[model samples]
Target: MGNPVQRPLPDIEDPLYQAHFQGLKDQQLRVQQCDACGQLQWPPRDLCKQCHGDRFHWPVMPDQAVVYTYSVVYRAPHPWFKEHLPYAIVVAELENGLRLLGNAFGADVEKIQCGVRVKAHFQHDEDSGVCFLRWVPTTS
Candidate 1:
C-alpha cells in the first residue's frame, strides 16, 4: 500500500454509495451501520461484512474524530491533486467507533500528529453531485 507514481484509474460510481454522497451534502457524515449487529462502517455498502447482513443504516457522524495514522505526501502522482500536494492523508477514528480514511485539510505538516482531534468538513461538487468529507483540526 503506497502512493503510486501513476494515477490510479477512475472508478465507476456505485448507486449504493449515492446515499452516502447525499448525506454529506446535507452536512452529515454518513456511514454504513449494520442493522443486524450494530456495527458502523465506512465505505458505504449494500451488505455488512461482519454478519452477512443485507440491511444497513446511514447514520450521521458525531462530527468528531481522532487521527489514527497519517502520511504526508510531498508529491502527487496526478495533476488533479497537485494543488493539494504535500498534504496529509489520514485514517481517523470517528466517535462512533468507525475508522474513516480521508484527506486532512487545513493542517500544517509540522502540526499534524496521531491522536490529533479533527472535525468533518464538507465540500460539494455540484457538477458531479459528489460531496467529499475532508478533515480539519479541531480546536481543543
Candidate 2:
C-alpha cells in the first residue's frame, strides 16, 4: 500500500519536529522551548538559537486560547483541501503568549470569530491516514 498522491503529509524524518508530531500523536500539544533560556520556538530547530542549547523542552499547551487571527480558505493550495473546501485556519494565542496555528474544527467555517475562546483538540483522519492538532471554539 502507498499513500495517495493527493494526500499531503509532513516529512516526519526530520528529528527537529519529530517530538512535535509525537506530541500530537499522543493527543498533547507540545511546542519546543529552549532548555537553557526557557524561550519557546516554532518550526523546530536543531539548537536553541537563543542560547545554543542542545536540549529541548516539551510543555503541554494550555487548554484556553483566543483567536488572534484567522482566514477563510475558500481556495485550497493543495488538492486534499479541495475536498474540504472553505476551511478556517486560525492563529490561536494561548494564555502563555504562545500562538498555535491550526485548523478550526467543525464545518461551520463562517463561525470563526476573532478573540473567540478556543481549546486544543486532536483529529485523526483514518481514511487519509493523517492526524491533526486542531483548535475548536469553546461553547458560548
Candidate 3:
C-alpha cells in the first residue's frame, strides 16, 4: 500500500469566487446573478455578461443537472491524479441553463454519457476547510 494522494486545492481566497467556495462549504450551490438584469452566470465575474451590470448577487442554484458532455481520462494529467485514472470529467447543465464543470465521482467511467442526469456532491477537506463540488449520476 502506498500513501494517499493529495489533490490540488482551489484558491478559495480569490474574492470573485469566494462565495462559490463558501456556498459549497455550506452545502449549497451558488452562482452569480446580475442584480440589474436578473441574469445568472457562472465562473464569477466583475461584470454581468448579459447586461454588463456591475452589481451582482450570489444565489443558491438547483442541485440537479443533465450531463451535457463528458470525457473519461485514461491518463493522469498530474501525479496527484494518478490514483484517479479513468475518472470521468463532466460538464453538466443546470435547469437554469448554466453549465458547470466537475469530476463525476463514484461513477463508472465507461457508462458516463451525454444527457445523463446527475446531482451535485459536495466534499469537504478537513485539513484546509475547503469544499469541492463533484457530480454523481442519479437514477431520477
Candidate 4:
C-alpha cells in the first residue's frame, strides 16, 4: 500500500505541544508540571487547571501506565489511517495519575482491556522528523 501523502501528526510548531513531542523523540514521556502548585497535567496548556498557574516545567514521566479505556476503530476517519483499521485507541493512566491518549498499533487488539499494563512506544518518522507516542501491552 502507498504511504499517506501526509501523516496526521501533531503540530510540533505549537509551543504548547512542542515539549511533549520532543520528549517522545527522545524516547521519554514528558508532561507539564505546574510550578506554582506542583500539579501534573497532559495536553500541555498555557496554565494549570488546578491553580491557574502560568509557570510550568516539562518533566519526564514514567514509561509505565495502565490502560484506563480503549476503543477499536472499525472505520478510519482519515484516509491515511484506512490501512490501520481495527486498531485500538487507548487512554492510559500514567503512574503519576495523568491520562494520555495513544494508539495500540503493534499490540494485539483482542488483548487490550481496562486495567491492562502498557508502556510507551515511540515511533519516529524519519521523513518528517516527527516522533509519535504509542502504547503496547507489557509482558509483565
Off by over 4 Å in 4: 1-3
RMSD of each: 5.3, 2.8, 1.9, 1.8
Local distance difference test values of all predictions, in order:
0.75, 0.80, 0.88, 0.87
Ranking by lDDT: 3, 4, 2, 1
Query: By summed lDDT, which 10 consecutive residues of candidate 4 come out lowest?
Result: 1-10
Distance from true position, residue 9, model 1, in Å? 10
lDDT of 4 by residue, 76-121 (tens): 8887778777789999998778899989774488678999999989
> Which candidate, 3 or 4, would have the higher lDDT against the true structure?
3
TM-score of each: 0.81, 0.85, 0.92, 0.92
The residue-by-residue lDDT of candidate 2 on 16-128, one tens digit each, is 87777778778888889988898787766888878888899888777679999998888889977887788899899988887888886457768898999988888876764
Higher-ranked by TM-score: 2 or 3: 3
> Relative to the unseen true structure, what is the C-alpha lDDT of residue 63 in candidate 4, on a scale of 0 to 100?
92
Error of 2 at 68 (Å): 1.0
> What is candidate 3's CA lDDT for residue 69?
96
Clashing pairs in 1: none
TM-score result, candidate 4: 0.92
Clashes of 3: 0
